[model samples]
Target: MAEDGAAGGRPCPICEEPLYKRHCKYVCPQHGVIMDCADTFWN
Candidate 1:
């Protein structure tokens, strides 16, 4: 099993908020609103 970094008091890089798992990755409102898994982003 992987470790939850935020559980140890880590903050998201951009928003500096507690990161919660949204789907496959962690989400910070200002930082990760764009899902990194997608291929066509601007489209």
Candidate 2:
């Protein structure tokens, strides 16, 4: 089964680990927040 908030199985550019969706952004556990969403600008 897939993880909740997982970013469509996309790998992190820094560590090659799976990215997770959190706070409207993609995060890498090892690297912290990796990418942010456009909606984040309003939050």
Candidate 3:
């Protein structure tokens, strides 16, 4: 399910779809919030 306040902006590197930022965190619709992606995203 889509996250609340997740308007869509950054695309997920894996799915290539828009990711939702909730509480300064990102979540993929298929995979949910990937912990490994944290470093890649912030860096």
Candidate 4:
């Protein structure tokens, strides 16, 4: 899996909060938020 760089200003697709690099995925701490990176990046 290609690693996404540090998501400094990248907002969470769900909570709208800032995103952070977590392993191979961008994770959100605001549980229950459906954050699809692919969909978010395209839109």
* lDDT tens readout by residue for model 4, 1-43: 3245455655676778767656435665674333455655534
RMSD of every candidate to native, in Å, equals 6.4, 5.1, 4.9, 4.7
- Expressed as tens digits, the lDDT of each residue in 1-43 for candidate 2 is 3455756555788889988877657788899888776755423
> lDDT tens string, model 3, 1-43?
4455464767787988887776646777887884333566464
Candidate 2 vs candidate 3: the TM-score winner is 2
Deviation in Å, model 4, residue 24 alpha carbon = 1.0
Q: After superposition, how far is residue 17 of candidate 2 from its true place, in Å?
A: 0.0
Ranking of candidates on TM-score, top first: 2, 3, 4, 1
The digit string of per-residue lDDT tens for model 1 on 5-42 reads 34323356666776555544556656764333253542
Those runs of model 2 whose alpha carbons end farther than 4 Å from true positions after fitting are 1-4, 39-43
Give the C-alpha miss distance for residue 4 in model 3, angstroms: 6.1
Question: CA lDDT of each candidate?
Answer: 0.49, 0.72, 0.66, 0.55
Error of 3 at 15 (Å): 0.7
Q: Pick the candidate with the highest lDDT.
A: 2
Model 2 has an lDDT value of 0.72
TM-score of each: 0.38, 0.62, 0.59, 0.45
Better of 3 and 4 by lDDT: 3
Assess candidate 2 and give its TM-score to the true structure. Answer: 0.62
